[model samples]
Target: MEKVNLVFGTVYGSAQFVAETLTSKIAELDFETNLIQSSDLTGFVPKEDELLIIVTSTTGQGDLPDDIAPWFAEMKSAAPYLPGLRYSIIGLGDSSYETFCGAAKQFDELFAELGAKPLTARLDIDACETMEPETDAVQWISTWHSAAQSLNQ
Candidate 1:
């Protein structure tokens, strides 16, 4: 009965917005879900049967938001083996930054090293672009839904 959980890390709040929208949309699509922020996680780990979707916004210099940095550092150091975890990430950032989406890239890599399986490719949504910020995320979720529905997470 493990549900899909949406974990977001935001500085200026764009990632939170995206996470909220995704939570609503995913619920509409009939999946049980939970939305959690970085500060909300303290000794949190997904059950072996759970799925996770991470949406994070890079802060200064493509750094992980201060709230989430410690968690990532801990995870990296601990290297928790989540062999049954399935996840995907949507990264928000401005393309102008030299390290655009660096945090997300790091997280994605780190998760793999921890033995989590990716449901789809990591998506980078550039706030600098003219398109709506959530457009790509929405589309990616739709595409992923069909594919993921057929598989066990």
Candidate 2:
């Protein structure tokens, strides 16, 4: 079975809720899914066959959540090459903020810089537009799953 690493960072837990909601959906698609907190990962590198899904919510002044900042910084400092990795990002933020989904954008850029290929376009869920980000995120998983399966075929 293919594997999905669902890594998430949350401030008040919205992102974590979204990630947890997707886990069952991912399993329904027959992919083995692992739900991980961003802070829990250390010196992590993606395997070629693994799919990485990053779900993050921006915090104060468009910064990564406290739990994820150190991990992201470490990854940046390591700057490992990731040409074989395929991934996607789900960003949750308010459009009214100057840096809406800024953390996710930063992650996307960093992944691109490290040569990680995106499985699909990033999904940005605006707090101003929706009360339930998990709903939007859940809808996106099917599309992302299709893209992941396509690569294997």
Question: What TM-score does candidate 2 reach?
Answer: 0.96
Q: What local lDDT score does residue 37 receive in model 2, on the 0 to 100 scale?
A: 67
RMSD in angstroms between candidate 1 and the native structure over all alpha carbons:
1.8
lDDT of 2 by residue, 1-153 (tens): 889998888999999999999998899989999987675688766676799999999998889998778878988999988899999999999999999999999899999999999999999999999999999998897799789879978
Per-model C-alpha lDDT, please?
Answer: 0.83, 0.90
Residues 1-153, model 1: lDDT tens digits = 337899888887778888888888888887888998777787777666777988998988878987778888888887889988889899998899899998899899999999999978898999888356677788788876875686744
Q: What's the C-alpha lDDT at position 84 in model 1?
A: 82
lDDT of 1: 0.83
Using TM-score as the measure, the top candidate is: 2
